[model samples]
Target: MTKETIQKTNPDKIDSILSDYILHDKLHQAVMISAPWGTGKTWYIQKKFIPSFESQHKKTWGVIYVSLFGITNFKELDDIIYHQFLDFYLSKSIHKKIPSKAIRFGETALSIVFANKLGLSSEDEMNKALKLIPQPDHIVYILDDIERSGLNLGELFGYVNNLCEHENSRVILVANESQILGRFNDTHKDKDKNNSVNTENIVTDEEKRIEAYYSAKEKTVGLTIKFQAAPDEVFEQVLNKVVDKREVQNLIRQEKNFILDLFTCSSNNDTETILNLRVLAFIDVTIADLYDSVKQYLDVFGKDNSFNDCLPSMINTAKNKIILDMVRYTALECFKFKMGKNLDGQSFSYLGSSNHYIYFLHIFPFVQRYIKQRIMNQDAVANYLKIVLKEEMVNQRLTKSVFPILNEWWLMNDLKVEKAIEQLEREEIPEGVGPEYIRGMMITLITLRERGFSIPIQHFTDKIIKYLNSMDKISFNNSAFSIVSIFANKDFIDLYNRTMKPVYDYVSQRLLDASLVEYRFLIDLQWDEEFPIKCRNHIASFSSDRRFLSIVSAEKISDKLKNANPGEIWYFCKGIREVYNISNVSDFYRADYETVDLVCKVIRDLIQQYEKHSLNKVKTSNLKMLLNLLDQTREKME
Candidate 1:
């Protein structure tokens, strides 16, 4: 088998068993290969079984493969088998030397003549005409997706029995036997309740269907083999097939083991193994897309080597974190896409809990958007990652130029200390700089003063407070104190609480209250088409205060909802649901509960008002749904 081909389970054993059955010319029964869904059974059979058979018994067997998926009737099954048989026989015929174009032209001409004179335009008529062609001998038939067929199991197995016993054709059946049995039990639970084979027979209809199925299998299916495949081998084959960019491919290849383990191993001792190849394909694509975004982030901000120089070990840890988080996120998305549900607690142990904001990847809004919508928004991702890296540097007490000096302050000479003090004095805090930079400067000055360096620590604190008080607007809020506590050491925390906390809180609160223009713009967008995007951006913004609901105007929102069109109202309510859902986990949105009750009341009133107007039924129904959603959100909050 090629490296790019998915590896079959116990290939040599299967090959030997199948070879024995095929080489025995007088076929009496069909062989069944059984496995769970998405285990690469179909791939292995096509890529492995067919080639081995053709190589070893080319003249002794004629193989015809047919998928029984969605085959509702015997006629449909017959048509498919007939077509496959025609292709297999023609490929081995003397007419194979004839160009396919001439063969197709002759067939089309024959079809036209039959349609006009012989009335063979209908499918049954066409089938009757085609059956006149000579049949090929020594046929080996592969019937796949047997469980997926719409035909009844008893009738389907009977057909296969006839093909094996009467026609003397070798047959291979591929299916998930458990699924077949499960489907039988489910559909036949009450079938023919009054009918009984005998008076002593108290069997349910489900038991009857199962008995009939097994009886047919006993006559037709000679042997059954369980299929299995190594997930790593299958994943590698899929990686080689789907991923195009070599660098991205190599990046994913590094995490092949962890990714496979996530699917195959259950943390809660659950016996079921997913080992889904389709989910693996999605994961490979997700990781490749996210890896590109990570590359772009590095390209944008990697040139500033000072942070790297100061903390190489931390930098390496963070880099490794980026790759692992990418895989974790991809695994989660793939599971949800393929399984149609979120991960359970058992999976959370491996994939990382979304409630934990300590991991930057789990909460990054743009990355979440990319995973769900498949729209990268590269600029947003790059910008978000840049802030995340900066936060990492700040939390580790290493900024661009300031932290290096203070980190090694004791080893530095007097001139260096003076230069560092001068840099802090003259440096203008940028418009969007985090509190960590300000906190870092304060911590450095406090350290200098404690060391008897004659540093004016109080002077710098006064200067910063005055500067912050004089600003026309400030985006930082009281919640920023949480960030301060995160990055602060014992001494800085003491000094900040004792001296700076009250004054900083008053000034920051004033600035936060003053910075209402952005919030107003966002609230006004409830009538615009861009409400959803703007609302998400508002929540995800680093500088903007997310505690808008604590201060938001319910009357204003209700008034706008009254005037907006259906699409705008949908977007508005969608944005509201997003905020309420996010509020369930985000501390930043905890204060939102103070006003959400009022918003819920407004939604209920709107629902009732829209109910009166027959023209606004869509709006009324949507409002009712939104009210129910709000009720659920409130329950979660309680």
Candidate 2:
């Protein structure tokens, strides 16, 4: 029998087990060590447990370490165990060719010989091998990350039981119990109850199986040791190594209390803390991905638009950034909670219940502070917020309609809400939204537009009307409302109309030219009528000068008409069809074929001229059809 020394940070437990094995003349072969990841499981085993056992037992006791990761099935399990056994027996300096089967057979035979050689000869060599060596005899095997191994847990337990019962050998399985318990429970439930007769029989079977395993192998004990996160004292020791300042260490200690509060308030169990840390690590990876994506976008698009502009260019872009940031913030908060710190005490600030408000508030303050600091110090803080709020009124209108949706999604997950409220409290802000709140309004608007929401202009215009009506009820002094109103005033509205008119005219002309103007577009236009009319009459009357058209077409009307098509010549002409369908332009639809043909000819000619240089690689069929349609209309004009 082998006498092993137990060297561990927590050596009392180890000594107790060793004492048990020595007094009973048996090896405690099967043991399960459970702990979470990053808990020093591997360090304890490699540095202390294995060395202490090997040093004390010497020639009698052998130690083997096996990692059970990437072994998803039972077949891999056999190969892994066999390989570990072989590696343990073969000297590190001896790199000679040794087949796995030879190693397996050698382990069995060598144990028998070694038992006899050690003066433990009793009955047969194999029987002697089964007996523990020296006083308290045991061999130790260390299994790491057993849960991640993807092995059949029940089958693994069965094998271990066999080794303990048959050979008087001990087996140790180390894993994160939180990760493995579900799988272990499921696997155990699938076992056939009737296979073992009774509970006592089952226990006896396991013991016998273990004994038989050791009889063939040698006298070995498995010690399973679970390492947990260090206590406050140990954590302080670790922190002292990482951080130099005593003040920072004290701050960390104080913050740990806040973190503990977050954990206790939000997490369902201790396992959640581990999961949260893993998630935070993932979020760090995602932040890197987002930064790379922004870098690439800037590289391709030029530095004229800053990183923040990438969000507001499209709804999709904005949504992606918001979602990514939210996830990242949540993960970061989770990490803080796990580490026993509050995120509110960190860099994050919570806005009121409105997500849109939060989104703008979070980003705007950073932008404002950055700009202020840079301007004051001549530093190079990029003005991204300037780009986002390039036209303040338009931005305000967009934000007011969109912020509710973000707030709704923010509150979807209970954990998110709890964390958000805690963060808000830290920020000294009110907790959640009030009643009668419009949830996900912006998301609805964006989705509607993407799904062929023909009336974004009208939808936005109507929302403006409602907003204006609600002005009396809404307190403009509120930070969120104040920020929004700053961008939605008359001058801002005028600028937005001026900036957007060209896009609208371009779309309208495409519709008229195609003879596809419809009622929906007209109705949508009605909502915009008040704004455009107000702008044109009071602020600026936009001239429908042909000079702007000249940039689109340089040739004569006749020359342009000569190159028209029958079906569709312009991409914008297709837009006309959609506009007409959406707007239900009855008169335009019911116009005489000659008038329609003439309109088509004019529009087709204009589109062709505009696209002439651009359509160098256009399909031949499309160009020819466009030309034919133009020619037919010109004949009518003549």
Q: Which is the leading candidate under TM-score?
A: 1
C-alpha RMSD between model 1 and the true structure: 14.8
C-alpha RMSD values across all candidates: 14.8, 18.7
- Candidate 1 per-residue lDDT, tens place, 1-638, comes to 00111223454578787888777745478888888788788998899889988998775667878888988987777766655655554434423322222222113223454344444467775565444333333678899998898876766777887877777777889999888886764333223556432334333477686785576577778778777666667878999998999987877877665566556443232333446677788888877777766866754575566565645666656656655666665655566556665322111112121111111123355555665677877777777777667655545543445654554676789888878777766665544445544654555566576667776656676777776766766655543432221211345446545655655767656865665555675464444557666666766552145455555576776676677677776776776665666444344454555466777898787777766665588777777776687666655555
Local distance difference test, each candidate: 0.62, 0.40
Per-candidate TM-scores read 0.54, 0.37
Could you tell me the TM-score of candidate 1?
0.54
Model 2 misplaced stretches (Cα beyond 4 Å): 1-29, 36-60, 72-76, 93-97, 105-137, 149-151, 176-227, 231-266, 269-381, 384-638
Best by lDDT: 1
Judged by whole-model lDDT over C-alpha atoms, candidate 2 comes out at: 0.40
